[model samples]
Every structure is written in C-alpha cells, then in structure tokens.
Target: MEKTFKNLEIYKVKKAESVQEFYENLSLNRPGLTIPSLDTLYDVGHFNVFTRGNCGSTGPVSYNRKDYYKISLVIGEGILFYPDQQIVVDGPALLLTNPDVPYHWQAGSEAQSGYFCLFTENFIRNRNETLRETLFSRIKDHPVIHLSDAQATVFSEIFKKMMAEMDGEYIHKFDLLRNYIHLLTHEAVKICPVNEASKPTNASARLASQFIDLLERQFPIDSTDRVVELKTAHDFAAKLSVHVNHLNHAVKEVTGKTTSDHISRRIANEAIALLRYTEWNISEIGYCLGFEYPANFNIFFKKQTQSTPKAFRKV
Candidate 1:
C-alpha cells in the first residue's frame, strides 16, 4: 500500500516553480498574456501585481509551492489545501502564501475576481528585520483570513496602489513598493491579530520557552551552506545547561511534548519545505538536515511523514 501511494494523485509532489518559470508557464498556458520585461523584474528583485480578470484560471491549479511570496485579495469563494488540512472560504478573503508551504486553490464558483501580488523576499527588505520575520511567520501559520466588506475595500485599495506604483518609472519606485508591502502585511496583522496564549510564568514553562526559542532560531533553512547543529535532546540540554532528563521533563510538562518530539517535528517541517521547494537531490537535502548518511535521513523522514524524500518529490 505504501509503494502504491507513490503513484497516487494525492501523494504526488510538484516542485516549487521559480519566478521565471512561473511566468513561462503562465505564458504557455495563457497565450497573449502580456507581462513586463523579465530583465526589469530581476533588476528590481522581481515584483508584480495583477487584477484577476474573468476569474483568473487557465485551468485547475495543482498543489504546489512557489519560490516567491504572494498576498491575494480573494473576492470569491475557494478551497485552500494544506498538507494535513483544508480551509473553505465562502466570501471575500485575504490569502497569504510563503515559499515554505505547498497548497492548491480551487474556486467554488465561476465568478471570481480579485487582486494578487508576488515578490521575492529581497524585494521587500527595508532594513526592518522584525517586520520581515513577522510577515512570513504569520503567513506560514495562518494562510487564509476571511475579510469583511470594509476590510476587503481596504486591501483592494492597497493592491491598487501597488499596481499604480509598479507602472510608474520613479527612481526609488522599489523602495515605495517595499513600503506598500509592509502596509499590506501590517494591515493584515491589524485585521487578524494572532491571539497569544499567556506568557510562561513558572520555571519549567520559562525553560521550555527558552528551548523552543533557541530551536526555532535555526529554522527555514534558506541556504545549504549552513546545517542544523543541534539535533538530539542531549545537544539541546547541554546548550541549555540542563540534564537531558530535566529538559525533557520541563518541555513535556509545559508543552505536552518531549524535547525530541519538538525537535523532530520542526526538523520534519523544514525537511518537507526543502524537499518541495528545492532542486537539491535527496542526499544533499539529507546532508543539509544533519544526516551523515542518506539512509538515516530516509528513516527519520519516513518515521515522521510515512514517505521518503524522493517519493515526496514525485515530479
């Protein structure tokens, strides 16, 4: 049954498409779709916005990730598919996507109209690291935000501003565009502020909090030059100046998950993201994840996800 799943449609994987490849496929699929010069796009770090005309579908889009981030003002109903869940939206909505997640959008009706913008991370770098981190962190956790008519109008106006800025030839247009991107992200946060569970007060909770923060600081794995260093409970325990058993007790007591469980889950998430978004071979990905042997990575991934990295990247 596991072997059969390799050929199953639901288990099939599509590698994330790059900006150039996205436009190439768009042109091939939607003939006569005029776009700005690709050269200009790269020179400006690749940013573009579009108004969805006549519903915006060459056909049903498949489940896949893109190499860029996207923010969309969805005006109609649709279903969004994640790895383990799906969300249905029946009205105006805001959709946020990052390079870390693979998803598919299926329209619920024929009448769909909205605006969306796609841009590389570097395009939005305004020296505000906090803003950049907040943007992608919120996007990865909550990709869909249902919108009210008033809120929809606000996002729509923002998109219009982005479109207008894109068409202009100002000397510092990219900087202006970055500001608009920040505006959209900040507005989204305002509309749907993530509710925080109260802060940790006890010593165990505080220690667990520190462990989680330290673990998360090594994430997303943007490049292969650096690899995850602390993989085992002992490693993290040593770093935190606690015994492995004590660390485990604190984390399990506070987060209801063992130190190993938290580490494994985070590493698994990064592995999946790297597998779906990168062209690196299975061995290289394994090495980047701190596996000295390909077989170890395969076993770990299979234990976490019930699928091999190669099998996960079917395409």
Candidate 2:
C-alpha cells in the first residue's frame, strides 16, 4: 500500500514541530518501551517501545531531517531505505539512524517486535565521543546488522531495564538510560564486520566521508537562528584536521568532484529551498547561507542557477 505523511498524522512536540513528534506518530508502544512526555525531557531524551501490529501501514515513511538520533532493536523483516541504498532486516537487527542522514522504512514481515530509543546528542552529556564514533556514520550502506538470538536477548534486557527505571520515580533515570544506550551500541560493534564497523579502507575515503558527514550534519537548518557552517572547502578541511590540498584531493578522488563543487552545490540547494519555502527576506536568506552581503549571494545564486535568488523565488 502507498503511504504519505498526510495519510498518517502530523505529530507535534513542544507545541511546535520537533524530533519528539516523530516518536508519537507510531501507533503502538509496547509494555516495556515507556515514552515520557516531551516537555518532561528538559535536557535529556525519550525512550519508547516498538511492537508488531502497532501502526497499521508499513510503507515508505517520510524523510526525517531534524535533530536527534534513533537506535532501534527490530525483530522481524523490513527494508531500510536510504537515498542511495536499502538494507534488508530479515531477522533481529540493531539499527542506528542519525540526524545527519535521512531514511525511510518498509515492513516485509507480518509481525514486528522491537524496542527503540530516541534521543538527542545532548542527552548523553559527557560522552560526546560515543556520538562521534564510526559506527553511527554508516547509515546509507550498512544501516542494519542482523543480531544473533543471544545478542538480541542481551539488548532486549537492556531495553526492559531502561523502561523499568523510567517507570519508577528514580531521579537519574535518564542518565542511567544513556549509559544503557552506550552499552547497547558498544555491544553491537562486536556483531558487525570488523572492517565495516570501524574506519574506512583508505585515508582519502576516511577524509572524504568525514568531510561529507560534517557538511551534511549542519543542514535542514532547524531554526532561523541557525546558519550554515563549513561553507568553504578550507573550513571543512580545518574542521577535519587535514590540509586543504589533502582534503581536496581526497574528496575529488572519492566523489569525482572537487571539494568546492560539493560545498557550492549543497549551499545552492539550501538557497533554493530557502527561497522556495521560507518567507525570509533575501538578506536573511543570504545571511543564513553564510553569505555576508546580499550582492554576493545574488552573484553566487546567479552563477549556480543562472538566476538571482529574488528572481528564482518569483518563479
């Protein structure tokens, strides 16, 4: 069956559109997966259950390009779709989806049983290193890894414990749940292939992936207060701790495009989206796109698309 966001429902969080809204759209919350109100999570995140026969339809889900990350323990069959790839989850699997990448899923099995935790990067607090690990970056190609029965049991217990603590009046339950999330991901590394779960094959691919990931993560501009970063190849290289030449060569060899081309293309795409969807003035749009002056943005837009931002917006 075909599905779209309208056919489902628009979930609201904090009386606005936020990541927590995605958590509410699911029709079923199994017994063990407890979801606290979005308002209650002042600084932490939400934990929830995923059970089979929950939501009626299992088709393509709308793309999510907001803040927050999700880790799901799914038992059943499903197809995880990315822009470039799709993974088959024919058995119990551990899946990680981050804000940097957008994906949708389709169910293949008649029954689905699992637990999923949704949280932002801030929820983990001190362990920012865990969030930046290589494991989270393989969303497009290696999104899901089928788990052994024993491994599934281990993860299932962790989710149960998380829900149990949440059910109690324990004050640091969120913190404890964060630790359990770490434990869950840490255990998953053992099951995935040694090569795929770790760093890339070559230094160039590593630099290319890092650069692309860093660039992508800054996007979907969650709020007007937020603006684009890493607007230039040199800025991206500096952030990646690599020389500009090295970064350029790596990106070109891996992607068949120069580093600047990627940046310009991404920025141009954002500019178009802003002009088309937002009511912001040209200056505001330009400012958010890292353009210091309106004229400069106008020239760049014309160069990229043969039309000025104002002119394009009119069309």
Candidate 3:
C-alpha cells in the first residue's frame, strides 16, 4: 500500500508575539517556522519567510535534524551546506530539501539579504502533481546550480515582484503570488538535467511507473514479510489487478527486471544501506525490514551476499 502525503505531519510558523520568542522557538525547532496555524499567516498555509533579524544571527547558522522541503534564494552573501555531501550556494541559488534527507547551513552575517520559502508536500501537490514527482526524483540527485548573470537577474526580478505582491493591499495578491511561484518552479526545472528518455510515456510505462510508486510506499520490507506477502509473481500481480504473465512482462519490459528480482534487489540494497549507515542491531534491523525471525533474515542475507549480516555491517 502506498502511503499518502496526508499521513505526514506538516508544520508552519505564523505569529511570534515577539522577535525573541520566534527566534527561541525556531532555534529549538525549525519546522515551527513553516507549519500553519501556530502563527498568524494560517490562511497562507504552508508558506512562510524568515529574514535575518527574524531569526537573529551574526554568523553562520546550523539546523540539525530539521525535516521540511525548502527553497532558499540567496540574494547577497552565499551559504554553505553539508548534508550527505558538501554544497555551497554563493549568489542567487535555489536549495531544495525533504525530511528524509538531513542538512546544515552556514550563513554569512549581513543585512536582510537572502530569502527562504518553505513549503509542504501539499503545497507542491496542489500547485502541480507532476512537480512533486520531478522534484523528489531528480533535484537532490544532481549538484547545486549557480544561476548565470542573466538567470540571476531574471530570478531577482521575480523575487522582487513576489515581495511587492506580498506587501500589496490587493484582495487577490495571494493568487498572484501563487502564479509567480509556479513560474519560479518552472524556471528551476528548466535547468535540472532529467533523463527525459528514461521517463515513461506509453501506457505500459505509466503502469510500470505506478507499480514502482506503489512498491516504494510499502518500503522497508522485512525479510519475513518478503517471503509471505510479495514472495511470488502472482501475489504482486493480484495486488496490481493484472495477470501474472502480464505483470512479469511489463516489469521486464520497463525495468529489465522480473518482479521477484526487483523486490529481492530492492530489499538487498536497503539492507546494505542500513547496515552501513545505522547502528541498529541485527534483530532490530530484521524487524524493520519485516522479518519475524532473525535466523531467517540471516539465512536470506547470507544467500544473497555470501556474508552474515554482522560481517556485511562491518564492511
């Protein structure tokens, strides 16, 4: 079963009673800055801004373990970020993030120089369905981009326009802002290097895409459940409401892997990542991957990689 975005908690910040209160609250929990209703801009929902003084800082700022998707446009001094890799954004750069990924930033001390727009998954879905897929699938996979002089000028103009509209007294200023945001996202996508040829366009390809999407939702598949639930081609085929042969054919045609093969490989890959990245014990790790018995998980792990889970964890 695919998990819906609604299940994920969304946070926004609105009213701070006082600047000190806001900074104190944000330094403790950054998500408060974007989660709606906790502040005054509840009507705007899932969108908020933080200037220099709002979160008073004279030097670089670091936010550890904060989970949210943000688009930051640096207008003056650049910011340095260290996530899984090191990234630096000097002038007029856009930074995208999600909760699954962690990041910290070092900002320069200056006047109200840069702008950050934080949005939720709902905001992305409401704006454009495909935008979420494209962004989540590609943005972080590539390197940070620094806009050219011409691109920077265009982005600066758009930012200025948005600020003006946000400050305007017009009744439909938010609607206008929404359109400007769309334009901004479209421009960002234009620079991203997505492998268009790899994108599925045909009906079979669409089905395959949906299948992968569904598979990811049931993620962290445990070793025990792996043998019971999606163990056979017919099991997944039935869940997908397609004939076993057809499912197998589509899976092979689109991804060049059989249904069972894909499942096994995904489970193996996730096990390796967890072994390398986390300190969870073998039994706990087995439970996380859906295995009821540690012994069974060890057998499967050894069969796949010719190494015990402990040995694999060490390597």
Candidate 4:
C-alpha cells in the first residue's frame, strides 16, 4: 500500500499530509520544537499520541486531507469545516477523520484542550479487520460526536492510559495501544453507530455524490509536477462509466449546478488556496492546476474572482 501511494500519479498531487510532512510543518510553524523519537514515526505501522497543545495550537488550517487516520478528543468549542457543511463542536467531542475527507479546523478559543492520536493504516493492518473498517472508512457525516461529561471522562481516561503506556518501557506496548484505539472506536460506535443510512438513497443523488467525491479527491493541488486528471464532464462521465448527458443531468438535478460549474468552481477554489498560502510562482501554480499556460490561469482566475491571480495574491 505504501508503495502504491508512492507510485500513484494521484498521490503525487500531495493533496494529503504525510506523517513526515505533518511533523515538518510542526517544526516550521513552532520553532524550537522537540518531539522524542521523531525518526521512529517514519517507519510503516507507526503510531503516536499527544496532548492538543503539545501538537500545536489549533489554529485555522486550509481545507486539506491527511494520509493517516486521526481520532481527536476535543474539549471546549471549535469549528470544523467540511466541503458540504460546517459543524460547530460546542463541547467535549470525539472527532474521527480519515484519509478520504478534506476539512479545515478553526480554533474557537484558548480554552480548547484534549488529546489526539494519529496512525497510518499499516499501524493496525492485519491485526483487527473489523476495527480497521469501523474506524477508517469514509465518514460521510457526523464524524464529530458530542459527548456528555461522563462520556468525556471515559475517553479522557483512555487517552491518559495511552499517554502512560507510551512513557512506559513495556515491550509490545504498541499492541496494547492498538487495543486502546479499538476500544475508542467501539466506545464511539456506542455513541453513534456507523451505518449506511447516511448515504444518499436515490440514483441521481448517488451519482451526484459520487461525482462530488471524485472531484474532491483531486483537490488542494499541492505539487507542481502533478495536475488534476479529471477536469471535464466527459472525463468524469467516462470514469464513472456513464454517458456524459446522463452524468450532467444527474448532477444538475441533485446539486442545482451544471457539471462544468462544479469543476470550474472547485478548480477556482484550489487556485485561490495555492495563490494565498503557497510560495510557488504563478506559472508553477497554473501548471499544477491543469492550465498549460500562465495566461490561461490568469484568465480563469479573473473570470472566477474578478481579480487577476497576481493581484489577488498581493492583496
């Protein structure tokens, strides 16, 4: 799986954060930071836990995906922005996010505190198949479960146990940690069961949902060498093995937007994010976003936002 990730053209787009990059970003954002045995996290099947502040401030983040699975226990208030909706987590909450979902976390206040642990798929692979599917599958909605005080205490104690185990010298400690992760998932299931009821029921809704998922999978274009592969309605229709007209009708029926409209809007959003947050030159950004010419990207950006990419970036 790791080899597939490295070789896949889609993965080269750098839409998702790798574990190494996650720490590197930490070091860059928080100077003089020190985390013990950082080198060990590079290995496959790695797992680690940290207190919220120890990880870093829960500041606003660009909407993006992670290559690893993460479970966060958030106390106090914060806002989670997914592409489709915004969720305000107002109290103690258990948040689960997988590799397939892109989201942004915006801190509400300094009062927020809790624990979060992240691990690669290999970390729990082959050990418990049921637990793996239960926790890491695509969580469509309700990924954040608001917890009562007693429930929060129960999860808090589990995280405390994980922290204690990490500090201890017990051999096979990770095995125990994996069990804790499993326990956490089971406990969360008790609060909110993962079910298919959240999925779209009708045909048009399903096709539209699939189209949106496929579109979202290609986003936050972080690398200059890679470009979005599915750019046109025909491209998406072919990939989904449907007629272009059929796909277009379904999407319009369900989303109230044309196929080209969704594509262009998403591409424009990525263009803005790259222009705002990245240091890449205009041409590099253009090429990565599937515009072969810098002039073309400028035109598209202007058409979408009524401002040239250069001028937008300056502002």
Candidate 5:
C-alpha cells in the first residue's frame, strides 16, 4: 500500500500564525512588525524560502493540500507526487500547489535549493481575480514544468527578485511580489502543455467522483456573504438525488471512505484554510461552516483536527 502522507518521516509545512512566523525560521522576520490578517481582500500573504537541511526539515513535503496557493521554483532534482500523477525530473521545475489539490515532493538529491512564494486568493483579488483565473485555467492540471538550465535561470531571476522585495521595507512590497508571481505563472504557461486526466469508467466511480465534487463546492468560505447549507450526508445525497445508503456505498466503494468521512475531511480542510487565512471571529467562521453556535464549531474543529480554531490559527 502507498504510504499515507502523515505516515512517513516527512517535513510538513504546517500553517502559520502570522507572515512573520513564515520567515522567522529563515532568520528573516523583522521584530516589532504587527501580524496581518488574511481575512480581508485588502490583506495579502507574503513570500519565503524553504531550503533542505534548514528549519529542521530533512526530507521533502509530504503529499498534502495547503490552505493557500503556492508557486515553487525548485532548482534541483526531485519527485513530485499527486493522487493521480507523479513526475520525476532532472534539474529545474516549476510547480504549483493549489488549495484544492493534494500533493507532495521528495528530493532526489541533497543539493535541493530554490525559491517559492506563497499567497492567498485575497492577494490576487485586488487585481480582480484575473491572474488567479488565468493561472488556474492554464495550470490546474499541468502544475509542474521541467525547465532547462537557462530557462531555470530566467525563472530563478523572478524568484530572486521576489526575495529581494521581501527583504526590502517598501510599503507596497507585497503588491510587488504579486506582480512577480504573475510573471512567473505567465512564463509557466508558455512552456507546459495542457494536461487532462481521463474520466472515471464505472458508475460507482462516477457517482463517488460527483459526490466528492458536490462536497467541495462549498468551501474556503472567504466571507459570510453566504452560509453552507449542506452539513450532512443526507444533504449531499439529496443534492445528488440518491438514497443516503446508495450515496454512502458508492463513496465507500470507490474511495474506501464513507460519505461522512469525505464530508468531514473537506470541512476540516476549509476550517483550516479559514483559520489560517481569515480574521473573522470563530463564531462568524463557524456560522459560515454551518454550525449554529461558536461552541459547536469549536468541538467539531477540535474533533476533526485535534486542535481548537484559535490554537490552529496560532500554529
């Protein structure tokens, strides 16, 4: 059996409390700066680097979905892992990790070195979601691209410039990182071909697939503009027009997990995303997630993740 991501001695890049926690391990967090909230459209996440043998991380990141979107320009040999795909490559490759996708990487060599910038949808929302939509459409499936040495240098320059911008005290520094991220993504589209996975072949598989999609449609909950109405397996079944037992059976048969399990896991993913990226108080966040009271959301989050919302946010 393939090892689950958490079942290995892998380096996990968990979420952070503030942007400073993101860079402090790199010896880069400036003292006396206030931590920013990721909840608002005006507030944006920042950039940082993760080098092998540093930050006590001995191996590559395990297969997982991050709460935020990431664009990593890896400069050494490594293997990229995904649920439906895996790619092993030589020197340089540009990789995108989306909140919706689960993936991991293991360095194939010790000389791993590169730059990666992490940002949220809020970061690009100010630009009117143009960059986010363009990059998403172009690279949603083909998130990795192998680059030649010279090509690597070109992308390298962009990331290097981002590092410099991050180090500088410009007020609009994050605004600038947004532009560099934009350029890096545009360059990736020019080099990679579109990749589409084949559709499922069986009825159980198709139903299970559709069920998963329906479950994920209500997510990130960036704001309280609307509330999630589907909070149970019955709700999802009703949406899919199937008996609860049938829905549960299809999901279990194809994914080896129950419908409730899928629902819970996706909810946990969204909870973590909001906790890490938003400034909404726990009650508002809970209401958005379909909980009627703050205490109930607290219990659910703690049960699903082994930590409370406040504690998880601090991590």
Candidate 6:
C-alpha cells in the first residue's frame, strides 16, 4: 500500500490564501512520513493555545519526520513519553522535539494550556548551525525543565510579543521569529537539568563519555579505519588513556554495559542504518562497518539483531 500521513495522526500545514484558510485546512490525519517542500509549506504558520484536552493519540509524534520542528510551551499539565523516557510538564515549560524521534503525550483533564509554533526545519536550521544538534538530538530524554517564576514570565512575554509581531505588517517578522526561536532555545536549555547521571563526574563516567564521544566521531566505520583503531576494547582503552579494566568499569557503571557492549551497539546501530537506508550489499556493508571478513560481520550482525544482515534489512 502507498504510504500516507493521513494514516498516522499527523497534519501538514501548507501555505494558504489566508490565515483563516490556513487554520481551516489543518488536518491531523496522516501516516507514513511527510517531507515538506519549502516553497509549498513554509508560509503556513499558527500561534495556537490549547487547554484541557488529551494529546489525542498514544504514538510517537515526530516533528522533523514530516518536515517540521514543533516548539511547544506547556502552560498546564501533561506528560510526554518516548520509548525510553518520560517528561512531565506540570507548569510553564518550553519543550522542543525534533522529527528524528517519535514522541507522544497524555495531557491531564484539568485544563492543559500551551502555545505551539510549527515551522519548517530548514527555516530554523538556516538561522544557526548548532541548531541541528541542539534541537534534534535524542537529548529530549532530558527535556522537562524547571523555570523560575520570573523566567517563565519572561518567556510568556516573549511569546506574546511574537504573537503580536505575527499580527503586524512588519517586513522582517520572519527574521524576528527566527531570533525569538534562538532565544527560546537558549532559555529551554538553560532551565533543563543536565543529565549528570548519564555523564558522570566519577572517573568511570568521564571515561565512558569520552569513549562514547570518540566512538560517535568515528561513525560509518569503514573497514580501513577499523583495521587500525578500535578493533577491540583494549584498543579503545588505550586511546582513551585508561586501562582496559578501568575503561570497562566506567562504561559499565554509566551505561550498565561493558566497553565491548558499547562498541558492539555502536557498530550494530550503524549496520542497521546502512542495511535499511542504503542499497549496499551485505558484504560491502559489513566491510564498511569494519569487518575484515564478511563471515565475521554476519556473525556479529546476527548476534545483535537476531537475524542475518540481509534478513534484518528485509524487515
């Protein structure tokens, strides 16, 4: 069957002849994925406030998945759940969810109010280089933020000002919105708590973070580089300037997995992406994923995915 966003409860806002037309055409019944073309969809905009309603569904809501990034300021009670985490917003809080991951929410019955702004990812990404990571990373696992009353007041005022600007005939209203978004991002990150447990101050946590950073930097691990560095836990430990045991301890302490587990998971994640997204042959994909021999790659892939690379790719 052909994929459609209507199958999934997703709404795409296309540029309309008038604001009334824009709102009237908003339909939240789509499925699969929607990629917004800047020319056709960028002009549609809304400054909406919702109070006391369920989030409508219990599935992942992806912002960038359908070509937009959604920014929501929670003014009431709700809980957003991702696969591995949950964020409870009981008061004024600003949350940003990227389209890369799926998210869902369950709002309380006692009147949940919030301001929502939807815009194309390109529209926001063009304004700042770091926004891709800041806005879209899996960091929403750490999304619930505690804002002081004063800070919340400031955010409210800014939202009101942006709403007013949208109503005005300013030539640079879009530019102003861009700046306002940047400000909002800064404020959200400032109020959000650091994932200290995830990034421990202890010797082990420090080592694990460094190891993870290094591992991530060496993504799409080609066969050539794999032959040189990170072929084993000991190799990774030496690079991190720590003993293998210490490195393993750190990784296990922070991630509940050994150094080898992290390495295997990283390799597996890359392999899955390659299998699903690219048409590379299994052997070539294995080579690119750092296996000297296709057989070795096959075994590793099977161990991690419970199926051969080809089988997993088919699914």
Give Cα-based local distance difference scores for all models.
0.74, 0.67, 0.55, 0.74, 0.67, 0.58
Q: Which segments of model 5 are wrong by more than 4 Å?
A: 1-46, 49-62, 125-134, 195-233, 243-315
lDDT of 1 by residue, 176-294 (tens): 88888888888888877666423556888788878988887777677788799999999999999999899998987654457897788777767766776688888888888899999
Model 4's TM-score against the true structure: 0.57
Listed in order, each prediction's TM-score against the native is 0.59, 0.55, 0.46, 0.57, 0.56, 0.46
lDDT, model 1: 0.74
Model 3 over residues 115-212: C-alpha lDDT tens digits?
66555433343311323354444654443557776886776677778777766799987667667667766777687756532355576666666666
Model 3: weakest 10-residue lDDT segment is 1-10
lDDT of 4 by residue, 183-243 (tens): 8887887788667437776898899889987987786575787798998999999999999
Runs in model 2 deviating more than 4 A are 1-17, 27-53, 56-61, 127-130, 134-141, 198-208, 212-234, 237-315
Better of 2 and 3 by lDDT: 2
RMSD of each: 12.1, 12.4, 17.4, 15.2, 8.2, 13.4
The 10 consecutive residues of candidate 6 with the worst lDDT sum are 42-51
Between 1 and 3, whose lDDT is larger?
A: 1
Q: Model 1 clash pairs?
A: none
Model 6 C-alpha lDDT per residue in residues 230-271, reported as the tens digit of each score = 657988888877888888877765554567866786677667
Clashing residue pair totals per candidate (backbone < 3 A): 0, 1, 16, 0, 0, 14
RMSD of 3: 17.4
What's the distance in Å from true for residue 79, model 3?
Answer: 4.8
Which candidate, 2 or 6, has the higher lDDT? 2
Cα-lDDT of candidate 3: 0.55
**Deviation in Å, model 2, residue 156 alpha carbon:** 1.0
Candidate 2's displacement at residue 70, Å, is: 1.0
